[model samples]
Target: MSVDVITFGLNHTSAPLAVREQVSLAGELMKPALTALRSAFGGAVREAAILSTCNRTEIYCAAEPSAARELPAWLADFQRVEADALQPHLYRHSQDEAVRHAFRVASGLDSMVLGEPQILGQMKDAVRTAEDAGALGTLLHQLFQRTFAVAKEVRSTTAIGEQSVSMAAAAVKLAQRVFGDLRQVKVLFIGAGEMIDLCATHFAAQHPARMTVANRTIARAEGLAGKISAGTMRLAELPEHLAEYDVVVSCTASALPILGLGMVERATRQRRRKPIVMVDLAVPRDIEAEVARLDDVYLYCVDDLGRLIQTATDARKAAVVQAEAIIETRVQHFMHWLGTRRVVPVIRDLHEAAGAMRAAELERARRALARGDDPEAVLEQLAHGLTQKYLHGPLAALNQSEGEHRDQLLTWLPKLYPLRER
Candidate 1:
C-alpha cells in the first residue's frame, strides 16, 4: 500500500482565534488526539502528527488518499465542534501541495508574522511528539527531515528574518503604547515557556520598576525570576497579586482561560479603574474574551499582535518570494522522493527474488563441481542459469504480448538491461 502525505486543518489565515483555540491541542492532549487520528477511517491513517499553535491547528499525516475528507471531520469530532461550523475554515493538501505547505510553514513564509523563527522550533516539537507517540512513520519522518533542511536553507540564504517583528517585541510595543514608558508600571509575566521568556527579556530591557514571574511550577518561575531579577509567585497566587501589576503578559498551555471576566473585573475595581495592558499570547488563551470588555483593560491576543507587526512586512514579503522559490524547488524534490518511496516494496521484492536465484545457481554450481564436472563448465552453466532466471519474467511477458504492448516491452527491455544493449 502506498501511503500519501496529507495535511489538513485551519491556520490563522483560514480561521479566527476563537475557532483556532477550540481545535488546538497541546502537551498531554496530543497523545490521545494522535491516537484518534491514526485510528480514523478504520486505519487508513498510518502515521499522524498535529501542530497546534496560537495561529494554527494543523494535522500532518501519512495515510491513504481516501482519508482526506475523513481527517477534517475527525478533527471536528475530536475537538467537539460542529463539522459544518469548522468545515469552511479547514484546508486540506496532499502530494506537492502538502510538501509545499510544510516547507513554507517551516521556513516561516506562511506565518502571520512573516518569517517568525519560532514556528520552526514549534514544528520540530510537533515532530518529536509524534515520534514519542509512535505516530511518525517513514513518510512523515522523511517529510519533516526535508522540511527542516529546507527551513535551514531558506533562513540561511534569505533575509527573511532580518528586521523581524517578533511577538515578544510586539507585546512590549503594545504595553508602551498603553503606558508612555514601562519604567514605573509593575509587569507580571505569566507562564515560564519560551514565549513568556522571550517577552520577559523584551520587557526587562525597558527597566521596569518591578517585575514578577507567575507560573504553575514555582521552580520554573524561580528560574525565570533569577534570570530577570524579578520576584516569583505561584499561579494560584495570581488573583491576590493581579491588582498589583499594571501590565500583564501571559502565555500558558492551559486549555481554559486563566483570567475570567469576573476575576479581571474585580481586579480592575480593586485597581480603581487604572488601565492594565494585557497581552494574552496563548492559543487557548490565558485571558478570557469577555475580559476585553472591561473599561480599564487594553487586551491584545496573538492575532492582534500579528496586525501590529506590519513594519517588517515589506522586507519580509520581498524575502518571501525568494524563499518561496527555494521552497518550491525543495517541494518538488520531496515529492520525487515520495514517488520513489511508493515503489519501495516492489524494489524490495525484486531484490529478494534475485538473491534467491543467485543462491540457487551457486548451489547448483557447487554440486556440479562435487560430482566431478569441469569447473569452467559449471561456471558457464551458473552464468547462463542466472541470466535465464533474471530474463524469464520479462521474456514471458514480451512473448505473450502483441503490437503496442510488445513494442512497449521491447522499448523498456533494453533500458532494464542496458548492458545487453551495449
Candidate 2:
C-alpha cells in the first residue's frame, strides 16, 4: 500500500463558529478520541493525534493509503455527524502537502491572525499530548522536529511576529477602554482553559487590584489561579462574587451561558452604579447578551475583540509579506525531501536485486572451484557474470531504442555507468 503520513481537518477559514464548536474536542477527551480513531480504522491507522483548538480541529496520522481514504468516515463517526455534513468543511493533505500545512501552522501562517506566535506553543503542546497518548511515531516525530525547526527559522529570519496583537493583549486593550486604568480594577476570569489562562496572564501583568479564576471544577480553578497567584472560586460562587470585580473576562466551553442578566444586575446594584467591564471570549458566550443592556455594565464579545484586532491589519501587512516568503522557501525545501522519500522503494529494490545477483554468482564460482576448475578462470567467470547480469536489462533496452529515445538512453547510460580509462 502507498501509505501516506497525512492530515485532515477543518479550521476557522473553512467552518463557521457553530460548526467548529460542534466538532471541537476538549483536551480531556483527546486520548479517547485518538484511541477511537485508531480502532475505527484498524491497522491502516498506525499512529494518530487530534489537535482541537477554538480555531481548528485537525487529525494528524501515520496511516496507509486506504486509511487516509477512510479517515473522513471515522471523523463522521467520532463526531456522530453525517459524513456529507462534515465533508464540506474538511480539508485533506498527504505527504508534502501535510508537511507544508504543519509547517505553516506552526509558523503561524495558517492562523486567523497571520504570523501570530501563539500557535507555535500550541503546536508544541499538541506534540506533547500526542506523545503522552502514545500517538507519536517515526513519521510524526520527524515531521514535528522539522516543523519546529522551520517555525524557528521563520520567526528569526522574518518580521512575522512584529506588530502582532495577541488575543490576551486585545482583551487588555478592550478592558482599558471601559475601566480607564486596569491597575485600579479587580479582574475575574471564568474557566481555566487556555484562553482564560492567557487572559489572566495579560490582565495580571497589568497589576490588577485582584485576579480571580472561577471554574466548574474548583481544583482546575485553583491550579490556574496558583500559577498567576490569583484567587480561585467555584462556578457557583461567581453569582455572589460578581459584584466584587471591576472587570470580568470569561471563555468556557459550557453549552449555556454561565453568567446571566440577573447576576450582572445584582452585581451592578452591589457596586452602586460603578462601571463593570466584561469581555466574553467564548463562542456560545459565558456572559449573556442582555447583560450588555445594563447602564453601568460594558460588555464586549469575541466579535468586538476581532474588530479591535482588525485595526492592526494594515500595520502588520508588510511583516506578513516577509513571513510568507520565508514559509514558501521552507515549503520548497520540505517538498524536495518528500520527493526523495518517494524513490526509496525503487532504490531498495535495486539494492536487493544486485545483492541476489552477487550471491548467485558466488555460489556458481564455489561450485566450479569444488569441481577442481582453475581458480583464476572461476574468478574471471564470476566477475564477468556479475557485471553482465547487472547491465543486461539496460544494455538490451538501449540497443533496441531508436532516434531521440536512443540518444536519451545513451546520455543517461554514461552517467549511470561511468567508466574510468587508464
Candidate 3:
C-alpha cells in the first residue's frame, strides 16, 4: 500500500473555542489518543502525530491512502461531534499538499496572527508527544525535521515574523482596554508554559505594580517568575491571592476549568467589584465561560484573543502570497524526493536480477573454457546466454502478440533493446 503524507484538522479559522475545546487533546491524553487511533485503524495508519494547540488540533499521518479518507469519521467519533458538523470545519491535504501545510503551519502562515513564532514551538511539542507515544515513524519524523528547517529558512529569508502581532500582544491590548494603565494594575499569569511566559513578558514590559506566576508546579512558576522578577505561588494558593491581582492570564493544558464561576465571584466580592481582566488562553479554558457573565469579571477566552489578532489580516495577505509561492516550490521539491523514493525497490530488484544472470553465465563460460573450449568461442556463448536470457520474455511476448499489440511491442522492442549497427 502506498502511504500518503497528510494533515487534517480544525483551527481558529474554522471553529470557535466551544467546538475546538471538545477536540483538543491534553498532553497527557495524547498518547492514549494516538494508541486508540492506531488500534482502531490498524495497519492502514502506519505512523501518526497529533498536534493539539490553542489555535488548532491537527493530525499528521503517514498512512495508507484509505486512512486519510476514513480519518474524519474517526476524529468525529473520538471527539463525540457529529461527522457532518465537523466536516465543514475540517480541512484535509495529501502528499505535497500535506507537506506544504506542515511547512506553512510551522512557519506561522496558518497562524491566527500572521508570522507569530509560538506555533513552531507548539508544533515541536506535539512532535515530541508523538514520539513519546510511539506514533512517529521515518516518514513523519523526516517531514517534521524538514518542516523545522523550512520554518527557519522562511524566518531568516523573509520578514515573515517581523512586526508580527502575537497572541501575547493581543492579550495585553485587551487588558489595556479594561485597565487604562497597566502600570497601576497587578498581573497574574496562571501557568508556566510558553503562552503564559509570553503573556508575562508582554505585561512585565508594561511594568505592572506587581506580577505573579501561579502554577501547579511551584518550581516551574518560580522559574518563570524569577526570569521576570515576579512573585510566585502554587496553584493551590490561587483563591487567597486571586483578589490581589487586577489582571489574570491563564493558559494551561488542564482538561477542566481552573477558575470557576464561584471562585471568580468570591474574588470579585473581595475586590469590592473592581474590574478583573481575565484572559483564558487554554483550549479547554483555564477560566470558566460562566465567569464572563459576572459584572466585575471580564473573561476572555482563546476566541476573544483570536478576534483581536484578526486586525492584521489585510497587512498579512501580501506576505501570505509570497509565503504561498515559497511553500509551492518547496512542495514540488519534496514530492520529487518522494517520487525518487518510490522507484528505489524496482532499481534494487533490477540490479540484483542482472547481477545473478551475469554470475550464472560467467560460471558456465568458465566451465566451458576449463573443458578445453576456445576462450573466444566460450566468451561468445556466454554473451549469447546472457543476451538471450535478458531478452527472452520480451521476445516471446512480441512473437506471441497479434494485431495492434504486436505492432506496439515491435515499436517498443527496438527502443527498449536498441542494437548497435555493425
Candidate 4:
C-alpha cells in the first residue's frame, strides 16, 4: 500500500493536563522522541515530526496505513503510560483529515484560547526541530508551508483573531477578580517561556505595584524582566520571595511541579492569611494541586483559564465561519495535490519506457541506413516503429480486457491522446 499522511495524538479537548503532560516531549527531547517513534514501527513510519506543547502532543507522520493503528501504543510505551489509559484520549486523523488538522491547529482554530497567536510560533519551532533531526520530508514540508500560508491568509483576511481573548488576558482577568485591584498587587512570573512572557505583558499593563521574573537561568529571567521593566530572580530564590507577590503566574517546561503544597503553605503562613491569586500554566503544573486547598491561596490551572475564554465574540464567530470555509477549500486543494503524487512513479516509469523505445528505434534506423537501405524508407520505418511501440500496450489491453475494464480503457484513451483541430 502507498504511504499516507497521518496525524495522531491528544490535545486539550481530548485529554486533561495530567495525561497530556505524561506524553509531552519537551524541546530538547523532540529529536530523541522522533527517533523512538520511527524505531517503534520498524520503518513503517517513514518521516515523522512530534509537536509537543502544553496544550497538545501530536505526531505527524508519513507512514504506511497499518502503522497508524500502532501509534497509540507507541506513544503509551514511549511515555511509559498504560495503553489502556492513554487510548481513550487519543484521536487519529489520516489523509485529508490529517492535513485539515494541521491547518486548523496552525490557524489557531483548535487552540484552548481561540485565535491565540502563540501556537503558530510553537508549531514553527516544532517543524524546525523536526527538520534539524532529519525527520522532515517533502510531504510534511509541503504541508507545513501551506499550513503557514493558510494561517497567514486567515489571519489577514478574516477577523478571527480580532479582539482576541488570549490566555494571558484571561489570566489577568482572573487576577483582577481575585485581588480586585491589580495596581495594589505585586505579581511574580515563574517562567521565561512564551506563555509566561505573554502573561507578564498582560499583567504589566495593569501597572501592578511590582513585577518579577524567575527562571532556572538567571540570564533568561533577566532578559524578560528587562523588557517588562521588572525585577529578576533565580529559581532557587522563589521560596524566600514567594510571600512577597499577591499574584503568581507560572508556565515552564518542567516535567514536575515547581511549587508544592509545603512551599505554598509556608508562603501563606508568612502572608498572614492575605489572599494570593496563583495561576499555573504549565502542563505538568508548576504549582501542586494540593496547594488549592490552602485558605489564603486561590489557585487556577490552564483548564480554568480555558473556560474563561470559551465564548467568542459575535464578530469572531462570524470570522470563524469564514475561516472554516477557506480552510475546507484549501484542504480539498491539498488533497488533490496529494492525489497527483500517487501517479508520480507511474508517470516516471512511462517516461523511462518511452525513452527506451525511442533509443531502440533510432539505432535500428541508423543500422538500416548504414546497410545502404533508402534513407526515406528508413525514416518511414522509424516513425512506424515508434507509433506501434507507443500503441502496443493500449492495444493489447483493449483486445484482452472485457466489459467494464475495456470500457474504462476506451474512455481514458481519448484523454491520453486528445484530437487536435487542424
Error of 2 at 107 (Å): 1.7
Report the backbone clash tally of model 2: 0
Sort order, lDDT high to low: 4, 1, 3, 2
Query: Which one wins by lDDT: 2 or 3?
Result: 3
Query: Each model's TM-score?
Result: 0.88, 0.82, 0.90, 0.94
Q: For residue 193, give model 1's deviation from the true position in Å.
A: 1.1
lDDT of 1 by residue, 285-329 (tens): 889998888897999999999899856666667888999889989
lDDT of each: 0.90, 0.83, 0.88, 0.91
Runs in model 4 lying further than 4 Å from the true structure? 374-377, 418-422
Backbone clash pairs for candidate 1 read: none
Q: What is the lDDT of residue 223 in candidate 3?
A: 91
Error of 2 at 237 (Å): 1.7
Q: What are the per-residue Cα lDDT tens digits for candidate 3 across 167-262? A: 899889998998878889999999999888888999989999999999998889989999899998888999888999899999998989988888
Worst 10 residues of 1 by lDDT: 413-422
Model 3 scores what on Cα lDDT?
Answer: 0.88
Task: Report lDDT (Cα) of residue 179, candidate 2.
Answer: 74
Residue 309 lDDT (model 4) = 86
Index of the highest-TM-score prediction? 4
